[model samples]
Target: MDKIKVIITDLDGTLLNKEHQISDYSKKIFKELYDRNYLIIVATGRHHLDAMPLVAGFDFPIYLVTSNGARIHNPNKELLFSFDIESDAIKSVLDLEIDPEFTTVLFKEDVWQTNKTNEKLNKFQKELNYRPEVVNFKNETDLKAIKMFFTHESHGKLIELRDKILVNHDHLFSHAFSLPYCLEFMDKSVDKSVAISKILEIENVRFDNAVSFGDGYNDEKMLTATAHGYIMGNAPESLKKKLPQLQIIDTNEFDGVAKFLAASFLDADVLKN
Candidate 1:
């Protein structure tokens, strides 16, 4: 096998443990890899600021693929590439005659905005330590949205909204479920794999030299695009079934990523013990 030059992993369900924190064990392993000159890249559905707390301990610089690949930031947090959702597309989603129970959040270049906050929003804020600005959507215009997220307790309702959007606006957007209750929308051309591809090109690394780890629907393309793709055991069986060729590791709660890395690139004894 070729040496892994680039390491890309998702945050929420791949690198983070059940408590939504990166374990010290994982941090140590990642730091060692960073010290060894491996390029560490975090690709997630999270905004860059929201993803920071989980990765704050690493002293080394890392690339960030945020908003499910709507934006990519360099090690210095400078924007490398971005694909903002069209203003018309944003307006179209805002105009959709959907149930009021569903909560919508719009991500711009720097901040996330929403018109309403609910229990789900509060829970998310508590986990990430970041909150969105509640703004009046009716008066909002000329907004450059990077991604739009919708969440509701009813999975069926979210699916209904997704199908409705796809029916008329499919040409303008790509949609996926980050969680069962969460639906995310991005530009038609945006995805983690696309962003990773661009980053790989910029770093002069081959796709075969990159190893990606992910578990959500948005991660499917990213995992597939790399030569070594790993799906977490906690991933939905449906996702595992879809990509049977990829290896399955332990769940995030068990520090699966760290274990795999130690076994694959570092000391095999880390897993033996």
Candidate 2:
């Protein structure tokens, strides 16, 4: 295989391991890939703020495509591009009939919001290390929200909500759970494929020269769009069943993305196969 000029990767279950941390081997390989002038792009369902920790203190000036494709940020956290949601739409979203099994989170700029929070929401707060402003359904607050998240114990219910949201709001973007317990949202155009295509245009790279990795329903369009897309072996059965044609790589626990990088761009023998 010839050199892939850019490598785009999803965060939660593709680049990040079971522990939700980038392994040392992966980080080392990333450095090597960057050193060789390969542009490493963080393409994920996460927001720009959620992406910062994984990239902090890294030597290279990596680019971030977050909120699906609603936001594009450089290593320095500069907003190279962004998309917004109207305040009324955000409020209307809160008014939707939310399943008690699912907790809805409102992302107003950088802060998160919830109505009558529960333990699950509290857990996420602890994980994120930030407390969101709690409000009753009656309270009115002026906040510029860009995204919303929903978490549910039932995968089926989550799927139902995802589909219903998209059906009801043609203008809104509704994505499947990036993890087993969540659903994320932004503008309908805010997907990794669209974001990466935009980035490719800005960077003057061809779609055929780009590669990407992902393991969820949200990643389907992105994988199909890229010239070379690797689906992690640990990807959900639904994804694997849908994308049998793409190459399947090992799990992130094994530094799967990096291993592919080393073989495809670094090792000569494997390149021949």
Please give each candidate's TM-score: 0.93, 0.88
Judge candidate 2 against the unseen true structure and give its global Cα lDDT, from 0 to 1: 0.75
lDDT of each: 0.85, 0.75
Per lDDT, the best of the predicted structures is 1
Q: Which pairs in model 2 have colliding backbones?
A: 69-190
Candidate 2's C-alpha runs over 4 A off are 116-131, 268-273
> How far does residue 164 in candidate 2 sit from its true spot (Å)?
3.7
Best by TM-score: 1
lDDT of 2 by residue, 1-273 (tens): 474698889987898887777877777777878888887888877666666776653557888987777788876678888886766766666667676556777766666677656675454221473457776644766644667778878878887887777766766654556766677777665677887887788888877888989988778888888789889998888778888899999998887887888777774543322
Cα TM-score of candidate 1: 0.93
**Count of clashes, each model:** 0, 1
> Which stretches of candidate 1 lie above 4 Å from their native place?
125-130, 269-273
